[model samples]
Target: MSNEHTTITESLAKVATRANELCNTVDAQIDNIKNTLKAEQDALQAKKTQFDAQAASSISQYQGKMDDFIESGDNRYQKALSKGDVIVPVNLKHLDDSKFYPVTLYHCKMLDVRVERYVHDDVSGGGILDYFVQLQNWSNGGDFTFAKQFHHSYSGRAFVGKISAASTPYTSSIWLRGGWSYKFYLNGHYSKGPVVIESETQVVERIASTDYFLAPITEVQPHVAANNFILGV
Candidate 1:
Protein backbone atom coordinates (compact mmCIF):
# COMPACT_ATOMS: atom_id res chain seq x y z
CA MET A 1 0.00 0.00 0.00
CA SER A 2 2.86 2.47 0.74
CA ASN A 3 4.53 1.85 -2.64
CA GLU A 4 1.25 2.46 -4.47
CA HIS A 5 0.80 5.72 -2.60
CA THR A 6 4.36 6.88 -3.52
CA THR A 7 3.81 6.11 -7.18
CA ILE A 8 0.54 8.07 -7.10
CA THR A 9 2.26 11.07 -5.48
CA GLU A 10 5.10 11.04 -8.06
CA SER A 11 2.62 10.87 -10.93
CA LEU A 12 0.68 13.87 -9.51
CA ALA A 13 3.93 15.92 -9.31
CA LYS A 14 4.80 15.16 -13.00
CA VAL A 15 1.31 16.21 -14.09
CA ALA A 16 1.62 19.49 -12.22
CA THR A 17 5.06 20.17 -13.85
CA ARG A 18 3.66 19.48 -17.31
CA ALA A 19 0.72 21.80 -16.70
CA ASN A 20 3.15 24.59 -15.61
CA GLU A 21 5.23 24.10 -18.78
CA LEU A 22 2.08 24.37 -20.96
CA CYS A 23 1.00 27.57 -19.16
CA ASN A 24 4.48 29.14 -19.67
CA THR A 25 4.47 28.28 -23.39
CA VAL A 26 1.02 29.85 -23.83
CA ASP A 27 2.14 33.06 -22.08
CA ALA A 28 5.24 33.32 -24.33
CA GLN A 29 3.15 32.90 -27.48
CA ILE A 30 0.65 35.54 -26.31
CA ASP A 31 3.50 38.01 -25.60
CA ASN A 32 5.03 37.41 -29.03
CA ILE A 33 1.71 37.99 -30.77
CA LYS A 34 1.23 41.22 -28.84
CA ASN A 35 4.69 42.44 -29.87
CA THR A 36 4.06 41.60 -33.52
CA LEU A 37 0.73 43.43 -33.51
CA LYS A 38 2.31 46.49 -31.93
CA ALA A 39 5.07 46.54 -34.56
CA GLU A 40 2.54 46.35 -37.39
CA GLN A 41 0.50 49.16 -35.84
CA ASP A 42 3.57 51.39 -35.60
CA ALA A 43 4.52 50.71 -39.23
CA LEU A 44 1.02 51.51 -40.42
CA GLN A 45 1.04 54.76 -38.44
CA ALA A 46 4.34 55.79 -40.04
CA LYS A 47 3.01 55.07 -43.54
CA LYS A 48 -0.12 57.13 -42.82
CA THR A 49 1.99 60.07 -41.69
CA GLN A 50 4.04 59.91 -44.87
CA PHE A 51 0.97 59.82 -47.02
CA ASP A 52 -0.53 62.81 -45.20
CA ALA A 53 2.62 64.83 -45.72
CA GLN A 54 2.67 64.07 -49.42
CA ALA A 55 -0.99 65.01 -49.76
CA ALA A 56 -0.44 68.29 -47.92
CA SER A 57 2.48 69.19 -50.16
CA SER A 58 0.45 68.48 -53.25
CA ILE A 59 -2.41 70.61 -51.94
CA SER A 60 -0.11 73.53 -51.23
CA GLN A 61 1.36 73.43 -54.72
CA TYR A 62 -2.07 73.29 -56.29
CA GLN A 63 -3.20 76.28 -54.26
CA GLY A 64 -0.15 78.27 -55.33
CA LYS A 65 -0.88 77.58 -58.98
CA MET A 66 -4.46 78.67 -58.49
CA ASP A 67 -3.31 81.92 -56.88
CA ASP A 68 -0.97 82.59 -59.78
CA PHE A 69 -3.72 81.99 -62.27
CA ILE A 70 -5.96 84.46 -60.47
CA GLU A 71 -3.25 87.12 -60.36
CA SER A 72 -2.16 86.63 -63.95
CA GLY A 73 -5.62 86.77 -65.45
CA ASP A 74 -4.84 83.71 -67.51
CA ASN A 75 -6.18 80.21 -67.37
CA ARG A 76 -3.65 77.58 -68.31
CA TYR A 77 -5.89 74.66 -67.50
CA GLN A 78 -8.84 75.56 -69.71
CA LYS A 79 -6.69 77.50 -72.18
CA ALA A 80 -9.03 80.47 -72.02
CA LEU A 81 -10.31 83.14 -69.71
CA SER A 82 -11.32 81.89 -66.29
CA LYS A 83 -14.13 83.11 -64.11
CA GLY A 84 -12.22 86.14 -62.79
CA ASP A 85 -10.26 86.86 -65.96
CA VAL A 86 -11.98 90.03 -67.16
CA ILE A 87 -11.09 93.20 -65.34
CA VAL A 88 -13.94 95.35 -64.15
CA PRO A 89 -14.16 98.70 -65.93
CA VAL A 90 -13.60 101.75 -63.79
CA ASN A 91 -16.26 103.67 -65.68
CA LEU A 92 -18.65 101.93 -68.09
CA LYS A 93 -20.84 104.82 -69.08
CA HIS A 94 -17.99 106.89 -70.48
CA LEU A 95 -18.24 104.79 -73.68
CA ASP A 96 -21.87 105.67 -74.27
CA ASP A 97 -23.34 108.54 -76.31
CA SER A 98 -26.82 108.84 -74.77
CA LYS A 99 -25.66 111.91 -72.85
CA PHE A 100 -25.15 113.92 -76.09
CA TYR A 101 -27.92 114.61 -78.64
CA PRO A 102 -28.34 115.98 -82.20
CA VAL A 103 -24.55 115.99 -82.73
CA THR A 104 -22.13 113.18 -83.43
CA LEU A 105 -19.81 112.38 -80.51
CA TYR A 106 -16.42 110.79 -80.11
CA HIS A 107 -15.52 108.78 -77.03
CA CYS A 108 -12.67 106.61 -75.82
CA LYS A 109 -12.23 104.69 -72.60
CA MET A 110 -9.56 102.29 -71.45
CA LEU A 111 -10.92 98.82 -70.99
CA ASP A 112 -7.79 96.98 -69.87
CA VAL A 113 -4.06 97.61 -69.52
CA ARG A 114 -1.11 95.60 -68.27
CA VAL A 115 2.63 96.26 -67.89
CA GLU A 116 5.52 93.82 -67.69
CA ARG A 117 9.26 93.90 -68.14
CA TYR A 118 9.37 90.72 -70.21
CA VAL A 119 7.18 90.16 -73.21
CA HIS A 120 5.10 87.02 -73.54
CA ASP A 121 2.32 86.02 -75.89
CA ASP A 122 -0.20 87.45 -73.43
CA VAL A 123 2.03 90.34 -72.39
CA SER A 124 3.45 93.08 -74.57
CA GLY A 125 7.16 93.83 -74.86
CA GLY A 126 9.07 95.80 -72.24
CA GLY A 127 8.47 99.58 -72.27
CA ILE A 128 5.33 98.88 -74.28
CA LEU A 129 1.71 99.59 -73.36
CA ASP A 130 -1.03 97.27 -74.63
CA TYR A 131 -4.47 98.77 -74.31
CA PHE A 132 -8.09 98.29 -75.38
CA VAL A 133 -10.21 101.35 -76.06
CA GLN A 134 -13.92 101.71 -76.67
CA LEU A 135 -15.28 104.24 -79.16
CA GLN A 136 -18.81 105.57 -79.82
CA ASN A 137 -20.49 107.68 -82.53
CA TRP A 138 -17.20 108.17 -84.37
CA SER A 139 -18.43 107.15 -87.81
CA ASN A 140 -21.93 108.68 -87.72
CA GLY A 141 -21.11 111.55 -90.06
CA GLY A 142 -17.94 110.52 -91.90
CA ASP A 143 -14.28 109.79 -91.19
CA PHE A 144 -13.64 111.74 -88.01
CA THR A 145 -10.28 112.70 -86.57
CA PHE A 146 -9.72 113.08 -82.84
CA ALA A 147 -6.71 113.54 -80.66
CA LYS A 148 -5.86 111.06 -77.91
CA GLN A 149 -3.85 112.34 -74.97
CA PHE A 150 -2.29 110.06 -72.37
CA HIS A 151 -1.15 111.58 -69.09
CA HIS A 152 0.45 110.09 -66.03
CA SER A 153 1.83 111.56 -62.83
CA TYR A 154 5.21 109.87 -63.15
CA SER A 155 5.83 110.95 -66.72
CA GLY A 156 6.76 114.62 -67.31
CA ARG A 157 5.44 114.49 -70.89
CA ALA A 158 2.00 113.76 -72.27
CA PHE A 159 1.71 111.47 -75.30
CA VAL A 160 -0.54 113.12 -77.86
CA GLY A 161 -1.65 111.76 -81.23
CA LYS A 162 -4.36 112.08 -83.82
CA ILE A 163 -6.18 108.75 -84.48
CA SER A 164 -8.62 108.31 -87.32
CA ALA A 165 -10.87 105.24 -87.33
CA ALA A 166 -14.41 104.29 -88.05
CA SER A 167 -16.76 103.57 -85.16
CA THR A 168 -15.54 100.29 -83.79
CA PRO A 169 -13.83 98.69 -80.83
CA TYR A 170 -10.17 99.65 -80.74
CA THR A 171 -7.19 97.67 -79.41
CA SER A 172 -3.62 98.68 -80.02
CA SER A 173 -0.09 98.34 -78.73
CA ILE A 174 1.36 100.72 -81.30
CA TRP A 175 1.69 104.00 -79.42
CA LEU A 176 3.34 103.86 -75.99
CA ARG A 177 1.33 106.74 -74.61
CA GLY A 178 1.50 108.28 -71.11
CA GLY A 179 5.32 108.21 -71.19
CA TRP A 180 5.19 104.53 -70.46
CA SER A 181 7.90 103.94 -73.04
CA TYR A 182 10.38 105.79 -70.84
CA LYS A 183 9.06 104.68 -67.44
CA PHE A 184 8.64 100.97 -68.07
CA TYR A 185 11.53 99.54 -66.07
CA LEU A 186 11.94 102.65 -63.91
CA ASN A 187 9.72 101.29 -61.12
CA GLY A 188 12.34 98.91 -59.74
CA HIS A 189 12.25 100.79 -56.43
CA TYR A 190 8.52 100.14 -56.08
CA SER A 191 7.55 97.23 -53.94
CA LYS A 192 5.02 95.89 -56.42
CA GLY A 193 6.79 95.52 -59.75
CA PRO A 194 8.89 97.48 -62.18
CA VAL A 195 5.73 98.20 -64.14
CA VAL A 196 2.46 99.45 -62.75
CA ILE A 197 -0.53 100.01 -65.03
CA GLU A 198 -3.84 101.67 -64.29
CA SER A 199 -6.83 101.15 -66.55
CA GLU A 200 -8.40 104.57 -66.96
CA THR A 201 -9.57 106.67 -69.94
CA GLN A 202 -10.09 110.28 -70.98
CA VAL A 203 -12.20 111.63 -73.85
CA VAL A 204 -12.19 114.96 -75.69
CA GLU A 205 -14.67 116.25 -78.24
CA ARG A 206 -13.90 118.13 -81.46
CA ILE A 207 -16.29 120.98 -82.21
CA ALA A 208 -16.77 122.12 -85.82
CA SER A 209 -17.46 125.80 -86.48
CA THR A 210 -20.89 125.12 -88.00
CA ASP A 211 -24.60 124.90 -87.19
CA TYR A 212 -24.15 121.95 -84.83
CA PHE A 213 -21.62 123.93 -82.81
CA LEU A 214 -23.90 126.97 -82.55
CA ALA A 215 -26.88 124.80 -81.74
CA PRO A 216 -25.19 123.33 -78.68
CA ILE A 217 -23.89 126.76 -77.58
CA THR A 218 -27.26 128.51 -77.88
CA GLU A 219 -29.93 125.86 -77.37
CA VAL A 220 -28.58 122.45 -76.26
CA GLN A 221 -26.03 123.87 -73.81
CA PRO A 222 -28.78 124.65 -71.34
CA HIS A 223 -30.29 121.15 -71.56
CA VAL A 224 -27.13 119.09 -72.16
CA ALA A 225 -25.05 117.91 -69.26
CA ALA A 226 -21.39 117.15 -69.87
CA ASN A 227 -20.64 113.51 -69.19
CA ASN A 228 -17.12 113.80 -67.88
CA PHE A 229 -14.86 110.92 -66.86
CA ILE A 230 -12.66 111.95 -63.96
CA LEU A 231 -9.19 110.55 -64.59
CA GLY A 232 -8.97 107.84 -61.91
CA VAL A 233 -6.58 105.09 -62.63
Candidate 2:
Protein backbone atom coordinates (compact mmCIF):
# COMPACT_ATOMS: atom_id res chain seq x y z
CA MET A 1 0.00 0.00 0.00
CA SER A 2 2.79 2.46 0.83
CA ASN A 3 4.54 1.71 -2.48
CA GLU A 4 1.32 2.28 -4.50
CA HIS A 5 0.74 5.68 -2.78
CA THR A 6 4.29 6.79 -3.60
CA THR A 7 3.84 5.88 -7.30
CA ILE A 8 0.59 7.83 -7.51
CA THR A 9 2.32 10.89 -5.95
CA GLU A 10 5.24 10.63 -8.41
CA SER A 11 2.86 10.34 -11.38
CA LEU A 12 0.99 13.51 -10.23
CA ALA A 13 4.29 15.35 -9.96
CA LYS A 14 5.28 14.33 -13.50
CA VAL A 15 1.94 15.56 -14.95
CA ALA A 16 2.42 19.01 -13.28
CA THR A 17 5.94 19.26 -14.74
CA ARG A 18 4.68 18.51 -18.27
CA ALA A 19 1.94 21.16 -17.94
CA ASN A 20 4.53 23.78 -16.85
CA GLU A 21 6.72 23.01 -19.87
CA LEU A 22 3.77 23.41 -22.31
CA CYS A 23 2.89 26.80 -20.75
CA ASN A 24 6.50 28.03 -21.20
CA THR A 25 6.49 26.90 -24.85
CA VAL A 26 3.24 28.77 -25.55
CA ASP A 27 4.62 31.98 -23.93
CA ALA A 28 7.73 31.81 -26.14
CA GLN A 29 5.60 31.49 -29.30
CA ILE A 30 3.52 34.57 -28.27
CA ASP A 31 6.70 36.62 -27.73
CA ASN A 32 8.00 35.68 -31.17
CA ILE A 33 4.72 36.83 -32.80
CA LYS A 34 4.92 40.21 -31.01
CA ASN A 35 8.49 40.72 -32.21
CA THR A 36 7.56 39.96 -35.81
CA LEU A 37 4.63 42.44 -35.76
CA LYS A 38 6.86 45.22 -34.43
CA ALA A 39 9.44 44.65 -37.16
CA GLU A 40 6.77 44.83 -39.87
CA GLN A 41 5.40 48.10 -38.43
CA ASP A 42 8.87 49.68 -38.48
CA ALA A 43 9.36 48.70 -42.12
CA LEU A 44 6.04 50.26 -43.07
CA GLN A 45 6.95 53.53 -41.33
CA ALA A 46 10.26 53.74 -43.22
CA LYS A 47 8.49 53.27 -46.53
CA LYS A 48 6.03 56.07 -45.74
CA THR A 49 8.85 58.44 -44.89
CA GLN A 50 10.60 57.66 -48.14
CA PHE A 51 7.41 58.18 -50.14
CA ASP A 52 6.76 61.58 -48.52
CA ALA A 53 10.30 62.77 -49.28
CA GLN A 54 10.05 61.71 -52.90
CA ALA A 55 6.70 63.51 -53.36
CA ALA A 56 8.07 66.76 -51.92
CA SER A 57 11.09 66.65 -54.21
CA SER A 58 8.91 66.06 -57.22
CA ILE A 59 6.64 69.02 -56.33
CA SER A 60 9.60 71.32 -55.90
CA GLN A 61 10.95 70.46 -59.32
CA TYR A 62 7.57 71.15 -60.91
CA GLN A 63 7.32 74.53 -59.22
CA GLY A 64 10.75 75.59 -60.47
CA LYS A 65 9.88 74.63 -64.02
CA MET A 66 6.62 76.55 -63.89
CA ASP A 67 8.42 79.69 -62.69
CA ASP A 68 10.91 79.53 -65.52
CA PHE A 69 8.17 79.06 -68.07
CA ILE A 70 6.34 82.10 -66.78
CA GLU A 71 9.45 84.28 -67.03
CA SER A 72 10.33 83.16 -70.52
CA GLY A 73 10.34 85.82 -73.27
CA ASP A 74 7.60 84.11 -75.16
CA ASN A 75 5.39 84.21 -72.11
CA ARG A 76 6.03 87.92 -71.65
CA TYR A 77 5.32 88.70 -75.27
CA GLN A 78 1.95 87.07 -74.96
CA LYS A 79 1.16 89.10 -71.87
CA ALA A 80 2.25 92.28 -73.60
CA LEU A 81 -0.08 91.60 -76.45
CA SER A 82 -2.86 91.99 -73.91
CA LYS A 83 -1.34 94.97 -71.98
CA GLY A 84 -0.67 96.80 -75.25
CA ASP A 85 2.45 98.70 -76.26
CA VAL A 86 3.76 102.18 -75.50
CA ILE A 87 4.83 104.31 -78.42
CA VAL A 88 7.58 106.85 -77.74
CA PRO A 89 7.61 109.83 -79.99
CA VAL A 90 10.57 110.06 -82.30
CA ASN A 91 11.11 113.70 -81.28
CA LEU A 92 10.56 113.89 -77.48
CA LYS A 93 12.77 116.84 -76.51
CA HIS A 94 11.30 118.98 -79.24
CA LEU A 95 7.62 118.47 -79.94
CA ASP A 96 5.41 120.36 -82.31
CA ASP A 97 3.40 123.08 -80.58
CA SER A 98 0.27 121.30 -81.70
CA LYS A 99 0.96 118.44 -79.28
CA PHE A 100 0.79 120.74 -76.23
CA TYR A 101 -2.70 122.09 -75.64
CA PRO A 102 -3.73 124.07 -72.54
CA VAL A 103 -4.65 121.64 -69.78
CA THR A 104 -6.24 122.57 -66.42
CA LEU A 105 -6.33 119.06 -65.02
CA TYR A 106 -5.94 118.70 -61.24
CA HIS A 107 -5.22 115.79 -58.93
CA CYS A 108 -4.12 115.41 -55.31
CA LYS A 109 -1.35 112.95 -56.08
CA MET A 110 1.23 113.00 -58.79
CA LEU A 111 4.15 110.59 -58.62
CA ASP A 112 7.59 111.21 -60.01
CA VAL A 113 8.58 109.48 -63.24
CA ARG A 114 12.11 108.98 -64.58
CA VAL A 115 13.26 108.34 -68.13
CA GLU A 116 16.61 107.99 -69.90
CA ARG A 117 17.20 108.01 -73.62
CA TYR A 118 19.64 105.97 -75.66
CA VAL A 119 20.17 105.04 -79.27
CA HIS A 120 18.04 102.26 -80.76
CA ASP A 121 19.87 99.75 -82.87
CA ASP A 122 17.59 99.39 -85.86
CA VAL A 123 19.37 96.93 -88.11
CA SER A 124 17.34 98.24 -90.98
CA GLY A 125 19.04 100.93 -93.07
CA GLY A 126 16.36 103.37 -91.86
CA GLY A 127 18.53 105.87 -89.92
CA ILE A 128 15.38 107.78 -88.85
CA LEU A 129 15.24 105.61 -85.69
CA ASP A 130 18.97 105.65 -85.02
CA TYR A 131 18.51 108.47 -82.51
CA PHE A 132 15.06 107.51 -81.28
CA VAL A 133 14.88 107.18 -77.51
CA GLN A 134 12.84 104.46 -75.87
CA LEU A 135 10.82 105.66 -72.88
CA GLN A 136 10.92 103.13 -70.09
CA ASN A 137 8.34 103.56 -67.35
CA TRP A 138 9.18 101.51 -64.30
CA SER A 139 6.19 101.46 -62.04
CA ASN A 140 7.23 102.96 -58.68
CA GLY A 141 6.76 101.34 -55.33
CA GLY A 142 5.18 102.99 -52.28
CA ASP A 143 2.19 105.31 -52.40
CA PHE A 144 4.28 108.49 -52.08
CA THR A 145 2.67 110.73 -54.68
CA PHE A 146 3.58 114.25 -55.72
CA ALA A 147 2.23 117.00 -57.98
CA LYS A 148 3.49 118.12 -61.37
CA GLN A 149 2.52 117.67 -64.97
CA PHE A 150 4.11 115.98 -67.97
CA HIS A 151 5.04 119.31 -69.56
CA HIS A 152 6.10 120.31 -73.02
CA SER A 153 9.07 122.64 -72.72
CA TYR A 154 8.43 124.36 -76.00
CA SER A 155 4.82 125.22 -75.26
CA GLY A 156 5.27 125.64 -71.47
CA ARG A 157 2.00 123.80 -71.16
CA ALA A 158 1.49 121.02 -68.63
CA PHE A 159 -0.95 118.20 -69.28
CA VAL A 160 -2.29 115.27 -67.31
CA GLY A 161 -4.66 112.28 -67.63
CA LYS A 162 -3.69 111.31 -71.11
CA ILE A 163 -2.21 107.87 -71.67
CA SER A 164 -2.94 107.30 -75.30
CA ALA A 165 -3.34 103.80 -76.72
CA ALA A 166 -2.45 105.24 -80.13
CA SER A 167 0.93 103.56 -79.94
CA THR A 168 0.77 101.36 -76.83
CA PRO A 169 0.91 101.49 -73.07
CA TYR A 170 3.98 102.83 -71.26
CA THR A 171 5.63 99.84 -69.57
CA SER A 172 8.93 98.73 -68.09
CA SER A 173 10.39 95.92 -66.08
CA ILE A 174 9.63 97.99 -63.03
CA TRP A 175 5.82 97.97 -63.65
CA LEU A 176 6.28 95.36 -66.37
CA ARG A 177 9.02 94.26 -68.71
CA GLY A 178 7.32 92.26 -71.39
CA GLY A 179 6.77 93.56 -74.86
CA TRP A 180 8.71 95.26 -77.60
CA SER A 181 12.45 95.71 -77.62
CA TYR A 182 12.10 98.89 -75.51
CA LYS A 183 13.16 98.30 -71.93
CA PHE A 184 13.53 101.14 -69.43
CA TYR A 185 13.71 100.91 -65.65
CA LEU A 186 12.92 104.20 -63.89
CA ASN A 187 11.60 105.45 -60.50
CA GLY A 188 9.24 108.37 -60.72
CA HIS A 189 5.59 109.29 -60.45
CA TYR A 190 2.70 110.28 -62.64
CA SER A 191 -0.65 111.68 -61.52
CA LYS A 192 -2.90 109.19 -59.80
CA GLY A 193 -5.62 108.09 -62.18
CA PRO A 194 -6.13 105.73 -65.08
CA VAL A 195 -3.57 106.96 -67.53
CA VAL A 196 -1.51 104.74 -69.81
CA ILE A 197 1.77 105.85 -71.35
CA GLU A 198 3.80 104.42 -74.19
CA SER A 199 6.93 106.03 -75.52
CA GLU A 200 8.83 104.65 -78.44
CA THR A 201 11.29 106.78 -80.29
CA GLN A 202 11.14 109.00 -77.22
CA VAL A 203 13.95 111.27 -75.96
CA VAL A 204 14.79 113.21 -72.81
CA GLU A 205 17.88 115.22 -71.86
CA ARG A 206 20.09 113.98 -69.04
CA ILE A 207 22.94 115.65 -67.15
CA ALA A 208 24.53 112.28 -66.51
CA SER A 209 22.90 110.45 -63.58
CA THR A 210 22.73 113.83 -61.75
CA ASP A 211 20.55 116.66 -62.95
CA TYR A 212 20.61 120.32 -61.83
CA PHE A 213 16.91 120.92 -62.49
CA LEU A 214 15.73 118.09 -60.20
CA ALA A 215 15.53 120.39 -57.14
CA PRO A 216 13.65 123.07 -59.00
CA ILE A 217 11.35 120.47 -60.49
CA THR A 218 10.55 119.07 -57.08
CA GLU A 219 9.97 122.54 -55.61
CA VAL A 220 7.59 123.40 -58.39
CA GLN A 221 5.78 120.08 -57.92
CA PRO A 222 4.78 120.98 -54.33
CA HIS A 223 3.49 124.33 -55.51
CA VAL A 224 -0.05 122.95 -55.73
CA ALA A 225 -2.09 125.12 -58.03
CA ALA A 226 -5.32 124.87 -60.02
CA ASN A 227 -4.29 127.47 -62.61
CA ASN A 228 -0.68 126.35 -63.01
CA PHE A 229 0.35 129.54 -61.11
CA ILE A 230 1.07 129.59 -57.37
CA LEU A 231 -1.27 127.67 -55.07
CA GLY A 232 -1.02 125.50 -51.95
CA VAL A 233 -2.82 122.35 -50.78
Judged by TM-score, which candidate is best? 1
The reply for model 2, stretches above 4 Å from the true place, is 73-233
Model 1: per-residue lDDT, tens digit, 1-233?
99999999999999999999999999999999999999999999999999999999999999998898788653453222122343221211222222211111223222112222113222243222222222222333344433232222211221212122222222122122332222121101111111112232222222453221201111223211122212444
Candidate 1: give its CA RMSD in angstroms: 16.4
* Tens-digit lDDT string for candidate 2 (60-127): 99998989788796775434323324322222222322232111111222222222222332223211
Off by over 4 Å in 1: 74-233
In candidate 1, the residue pairs with backbone N, CA or C atoms under 3 Å apart (3 or more residues apart, or in different chains) clash, namely none
RMSD (CA, Å), each prediction: 16.4, 16.7
For all candidates in order, the CA lDDT equals 0.34, 0.33
